[model samples]
Target: MTSHKRWGLFFFLAPVVLWLFVMIVLPHIDLLVMSFRFENDEGQMQWSLNNYLAFFEEPIYWLTFVRTAIYSILVTFLTFVIALPLAFYITKVVNPKYQGFLLVLLLLPFWVSELVRVYGWMILLRESGVINHFLLKAGILRQPIEMLYRDSTMILGLVYTSMLFMVVPIVSVLDSLDNSLIEAAYDLGANMWTILFKIIIPHASPGIMSGSIVVFMLTLGNYLTPNLMGGKNSLWFTEQIYNQFIASFNWNQGSAFGFLLLVLSSIVVWLGLKLTRQNLKKVVQ
Candidate 1:
């Protein structure tokens, strides 16, 4: 490469490298240090494992963490199940002329902010809200149902908010597939299920893995949907972190919880890759 081309490449990469180091690496290092320290009875700051120990010692903390992990997994799985068929339909069944329009429809909800979307659900699901009001007027129910502030509602919110992330990846992969492959499989006497499992799935595995990872992480870390939809009944781990930092002013404990969440997400992603036998390099591409 010429000197000018090398300089151009360096300038192109420098901003990203600097941004990652400044925004991600530095803050995480500070948080890691904070997690290990605590104020003692004398009001002296001391380095110790008390913050982490408190998480295991408190039932509420550890139980909520486990619950968050379970809920996040459910959300990811639900998003995958919902997105896959929609993606396939858009990529394969829809007329090419109308595919862009249909995809835009899927994206329309996302044009609004997440806060607005969650509040919209609140309007639909709350007692005396749109659904209940319609049902009551239509003589379908005796009274308004209490639909808000529930686990199912929270999961629905997460899935709705994360749908586009899942669909885009799957559609991108499926769009790249050649129609000849499906025809060849069918010509060899393969049924739909056989072809789906043997051919389509293998080709789309990377996209599936990529979408699952993104959805899982976003759902796990999300605070707004659970807080708004589930109300106080939501025992999400992010709520715990929020309380430690904002409500209780216990930064040490909050830092510990934050790191534990990071660790948990890393472990889950690693296990997913292992089970799927997917290469991270290929999946990201």
Candidate 2:
């Protein structure tokens, strides 16, 4: 509260505030403006809603948008299902001495870039990749299976990359849980499932909500893993945006698509928070 401390806080916060405003805020403002405008017949730039209208008018665009949202939600739920048990094991079942080591093991693959990790999957899943090659050599298969470019492969990639985010948050919450609570529930004749459902889940709800939000947003906006793992069959809305901006060089349409995505994803997040009875403050905390 002193002047010197205030100055210190200002110095610490100023750079972050400045960077967000310059790098994130300004560009989004420009994108908003660009999305609402188009060139007229007289070769003049004019404001119009055609960029957004085209999304509803084009089947491919709207369909891809719905597909992306559905797939993102699926990936988020899958990540949670996979992460919850791992988090519980890491927090409650693992030996305290080895817990950090196990955590490190979980983090090891992520030290490398996500592209590298997806490429590792590619190496394992491709037609002549390690898995197929091994099966062929062991006489367990007639020929290499075409495992890549499938929707499952893309979901797998998304889940793998998003796993750490879910796990870390849940682990942080579960680590604080008291063993006495479980013991008390057991003393009252509660079974393992009962304790888990009644005590563990409620205590970890905030972490679960936090992780789900982060994972949902990350997977919704993700471009690399889906594109690489799913290949030409991905049909992700991000690919549509990319095609508009990069391939077709239609910035106006691309910006409209981008804003549409952001808005719809935000609505989904809000609905999730409402359904789960969570709030932004608790999620952040």
Report RMSD (Å) for each prediction in the order shown: 1.2, 1.3
Worst-scoring 10-residue span by lDDT in model 1: 196-205
The TM-score, computed over Cα atoms with residue i paired to residue i, of candidate 1 is 0.97
Best by lDDT: 1
* Model 2 C-alpha lDDT per residue in residues 113-194, reported as the tens digit of each score: 9989999999999998999999999999998899999999999999999999999999999999998999999999999999
lDDT, candidates in the order shown: 0.95, 0.95
Give per-candidate clash totals: 0, 0
Q: Per-residue error at 153 for model 1, in Å?
A: 0.6
lDDT of 1: 0.95
lDDT for model 2: 0.95
